[model samples]
Target: MKQGTGGKIINVASMLSFQGGIRVPSYTASKSGVMGITRLMANEWAKHGINANAIAPGYMATNNTAPIRADEARNRSIQERIPADRWGTPEDLAGPVVFLASQASNYVNGHTLAVDGGWLAR
Candidate 1:
């Protein structure tokens, strides 16, 4: 940013950052740390024109979630919890990433953007 320009830093974190998740205590700790780091970076670098932010994805449909998605009971439970009524696709995160990396969010800083099919809403 010293070169007379601004930069955007987007972190792929998780909803666990906001809530205490089950079974995976370490995962929760690390991702929560990501938020702290993102905010710290934004605070220390904003003067240098750096915009740091994070994306907290909730219940995404991916290999990591294959076991849970495969279990009908668990799948139903998860989908029901999300306001969107479905597990989020990786594609669901695209728009938020674009917005954060573009001028659209130029004024946004140290924010944790949720791309969780509205799961946090519920």
Candidate 2:
């Protein structure tokens, strides 16, 4: 992308970047790398009109997290930890993604927007 027309690069990151799961070492490491790359690319491309950012989503009730949600106790515990007191929905992240992709956020760069129902705040 750097060599092509200058453009925005949005990275899909996860809340795991801020917190670690008990048994998911690789997932955690990968997300941390996403954040690192977002920052690095943003710094390198600022002068060329290319923006880089990341979106870190919380436990959305998606196919990937269905197993966790299916466990009643686990689901309840997860909800309690989030300030919003509920699981996130894919729709909840749409606005952030749109904002980053549009000219409305031209000044924004190297930011990791968390659509996690305030999970990281807890």
User: Where does candidate 1 stray beyond 4 Å?
Assistant: none
Q: Write the per-residue lDDT of candidate 2 for residues 1-122, one digit (tens) a residue.
A: 54776788899999987777679889999998898999999999988989999999999989989999999999999999999999989999899999999988899999999989988987
The clash number for model 1 is 0
Q: Which ranges of candidate 2 are over 4 A from the true structure? A: 1-5
Per-residue alpha-carbon lDDT of model 1 for 22-109, expressed as tens digits? 9999999999999999999999989888999999998988998999999999899889999888888899889999999999898899
Provide the lDDT at 91 for model 1. Answer: 91
The global C-alpha lDDT for each of the candidates, from Candidate 1 onward, is 0.91, 0.91
> Lowest lDDT 10-mer window, candidate 1?
1-10
Cα misplacement distance, residue 78 of candidate 1 (Å):
0.7
RMSD of each: 1.0, 1.6
